[model samples]
Target: MWVNLGVILLQFLSGSIMYSYIIARILKVDLSKIRDGNPGASNLWRAVGWKYGILALFLDYLKGALPLAIFVSLGIVKDNFVISLAALSGVLGHAFSPILRFKGGKAVAVSFGAWSVLTKWEAPMLLGTIFTIFTIIKPKGTTVQEDAFRVILGYLFLLPYIIYKSFHGDFHLLIFYDGNFAVILYKHYKDLWGYLRGQS
Candidate 1:
């Protein structure tokens, strides 16, 4: 019981750290007044450059992946449930990082990292489709609203797969697995609502 509690606590702690903000600060960028008003890699990409964006993305991804790697290596979380929970911490971290006063990114990249470890090849397939769709549809300098649409379309593409896999297989391994994506969707709900209102 104590071991499980420890794992959960560590997950929360790991997920709460805001690495992107830290990177931004190191780069001498004030991320609180940027595009989307976020300290995420995307904002950092625009603030600094693509090189910084790539580096931030890598560090953000590694933060999640490294913790899961540690849990798997230490054998502290052998069950899929525990693994999923720990991985979700990274996504949650990206979404509501304590370092950023609980205001963080939309959790897309962190979730993608976690899914990559759990779902293997299918993970890249999902992420690639999202990237390709955005690249094709997004304008050269897309607004926040435009980016949100890309995100929604990316998620919509995976809806069928999520429903199919959850109902068709031993999906207990996916309890908090999809939570990462859901968190992102929840974060961007406001943008979605605006889009709906405009359509009507």
Candidate 2:
């Protein structure tokens, strides 16, 4: 039990690396001074171009995927829990990275990576569906409002899965679906408000 607790704590700490922010600082860019004040891939692309943006995205994904990979390699936890904890930690780190004063990205890629590893079939299928939708109806402008709407709509679409998994007694499923989904929704609380106001 203590070992499990320690692993969880380590996972959270590792997840909070804020790869994008760190890279921005290393490149001598003050992300807070930029438009939208977000240190994510899209903003990085605008500020630095595709190369740095892609690098930051990859590192952010790695920060989540690698730790779980380590957990499995070390036989630190059972398969189910390790995958669950890893996905949670990775996304949590990306969303509320302590290193960046709790300012971070939308937890999309990191969550996708961890989910893909943890639940090979379901995770990919779900994420692919989201990708397809976004591809078809890509948002025009690059604003926090647009990004937030994308996240809120995406999670609303997936809410049914969370309900189904809960009834099926698949708590590990919840670990992947509910915990991460809820985090994304809560993170975009302001966006939700803006969206509702516009509709009214």
Q: In order, how many clashes per candidate? A: 1, 0
Q: Per-residue CA lDDT of candidate 1, range 136-196, in tens?
A: 7654666676666777777767767767777877374357646766787788888767666
Each prediction's RMSD to truth: 2.6, 2.8
Off by over 4 Å in 2: 139-142, 162-169
lDDT of 2 by residue, 158-189 (tens): 66775687687756767677788788878777
Q: lDDT of each structure?
A: 0.72, 0.71
Kindly report the root-mean-square deviation of model 1 from the true structure over all alpha carbons. 2.6
Query: Which candidate's TM-score is highest?
Result: 1
List candidate 1 segments past 4 Å from native. Answer: 198-200
